[model samples]
Target: MNWQELGKQVADYAPLLGGVLGGPSGAAFGTILASKFGTKETPNDIAAAIQADPNAALKLKEVESNNETKLQELYLKDKQNARLSHKDSRMPAALSIALTLFVVLVVYLLFFAPVPDASKDVLFMLLGVVVKEWSNAMQYWYGTTRSSSDKTKLIAARN
Candidate 1:
């Protein structure tokens, strides 16, 4: 729905829903019954009288249905937003992880594998990339795995 229409709907329905959720109590019901009955009556007395009145029950049912519809609409909007965000981010995230792993492998071959000083600049650059990625990945998953739960207990005991 467009923003303007959605805003209008919220403006119109919020008060009605608030009244229904609050039930036919307090000032609203007092005003309604006082005007109709032309006497002072407590909210509970008004409610008991309304229970015997078929017309009031029908009006209440209509309000309850409209409130349920509005709640369903809001829930579907949230679900759609979550789906769109996850779909947009998945591919780029996988590509970043793959690139980091490739750089790490290349660095290992150049620095630790049987290779000479002629490629030292390339080796250092690759090594730097590997170390950066390793540190970042470690930080990202820190305390995220099953083993970390045990580590946490140990640290807690020490403290």
Candidate 2:
């Protein structure tokens, strides 16, 4: 199957898996597919491999679990570090402000202030950025793993 077909198969079957696999699991699945197999691997290919070797799916799940553990550890450390400093940190304060404005603008335009279509369009465009950034900030579990260069940078930052 082609990439598009593989994506379609994932979309169709993923929801049935439920939980993380069902919701917003595309990135995780894609990472597993691309890294374990290859970018060109398809759903049919995965299914065949799993049938031939039952360990195939298990290996992918292991990768996902390891990534989740690492992200959880890192996130918890950030939380603990903040607590030890005795300072509350709103790391996304500016994003919060922008999202607030987006909500207010949406509510205002929808109910009270019937804005022009062009202005509404602009508001929606800005709202999209907020949504995208919010997702990306939480994407470590399903996002691509750090490359060697990025790993070096991460180690350097620790020192």
TM-scores of all predicted structures:
0.27, 0.27
Scored by lDDT, model 2 comes in at: 0.51
Model 2 over residues 1-159: C-alpha lDDT tens digits? Answer: 443444444334332221233223434454565566544344566645544554655655554565665434544664556544643345545555666666666666657877788787877776677667655643522345324436756898999
Clashes of each: 0, 0
lDDT of 1 by residue, 41-155 (tens): 5545444544456565454445446446654454465555554465545554565577677776786787579877787787778778767766565554453642564576699
- Of candidate 1, the 10-residue stretch with the lowest lDDT total is 1-10
Compared to the true structure, candidate 2 yields what TM-score? Answer: 0.27
**What's the true lDDT of residue 130 in model 1?**
68
lDDT against the true structure, per candidate, is 0.51, 0.51
Clashing pairs in 2: none
Lowest summed lDDT across 10 adjacent residues in model 2 is found at: 14-23
